[model samples]
Target: MKITLIIPTYNAGSLWPNVLDAIKQQTIYPDKLIVIDSGSKDETVPLASDLKNISIFNIDSKDFNHGGTRNLAVAKTLDADVIIFLTQDAILADSDAIKNLVYYFSDPLIAAVCGRQLPHKDAN
Candidate 1:
């Protein structure tokens, strides 16, 4: 199945670089990576812009609605069979992360699958 990844970001700073690194380690690469950035004053846009398979769109920070922005990203990826959402701070524990998550969709009834979220090492 063709899958697309959508990540919503603001001034994500150094967190997003680690997230992208983890993505690169995934056994299965997403067919497309759509980054919806909300007017970050930092380097967030430039950092994700050059990545392979990445498509970026910008919106005013005030215009960024978690639900609405995600809906817009979904609309842009009509070609994908499944959509995966991730936060900029999320990092995969292993290369099998995406592979394992996508496996659940083998059942036609399963419309979506969410990966496990472990607390960050620095999280209190």
Candidate 2:
């Protein structure tokens, strides 16, 4: 099954690298990776520039509508069997994170699946 990952980011300077590393280690990497950035004035764009299967789209920071931005990414990867929504701050719990989420879809009854998110240690 094909899976696409969509991330909405803003000023994700320090955090985006970790997010990219985690994506690289996923048990099953997404067939497509789309990052809709609201004009981050940092290295967020450059850091993601050379990654495989990744496409970065830019928009005015003020134009970001949480739902609309994600919808735009979804519309771009229509052939994907699943579209994963994530924020820049989210780090996968383990390599199986994406693998497990997609595994659930093997059951035809499950139309879509969302994974659990735990607070970052810094949030403590």
Candidate 3:
């Protein structure tokens, strides 16, 4: 099944690179990766652009609404069989995270799935 992954970013901070790296290292990468970024003064847009196969769409910071931004991203991925949404700061815990999650879709009745989150290893 074709999978599309969308991440909404706004000044994602220093951890952005790590988040992208973790995604790139996934055992099963998304067929399409899209980043919807509101006006960010930082390097969020540049960093996302440097990655191949990532499509970036910009919106005014004032127009950014959590739900609306996500809906916008979804609009661009109509052809995908599965769409996965992740926040800019979310770091996948392991290479198999996406692979494991997609495996659940094999069940015909599973319409949606949510993954668990754990604190970072160094969280205080």
lDDT of 3 by residue, 1-124 (tens): 9889999999998889998999989989898899999998899999888775789999999999999999999999899888889888889989998998899999999999988987766754
Local lDDT at 90 for model 3 = 86
CA deviation > 4 Å runs, candidate 1: none
Residue 40: error of model 3 in Å? 0.9
Q: What's the TM-score of every candidate structure?
A: 0.95, 0.95, 0.94
Model 2: ten consecutive residues of lowest lDDT: 115-124
Question: Please, what is the whole-model Cα lDDT of each candidate in the order they appear?
Answer: 0.89, 0.88, 0.90
lDDT of 2 by residue, 74-109 (tens): 888999998899899898989889998999898999
Query: What range of 10 consecutive residues in model 3 has the weakest lDDT sum?
Result: 115-124
Off by over 4 Å in 2: none
RMSD in angstroms between candidate 3 and the native structure over all alpha carbons: 1.5
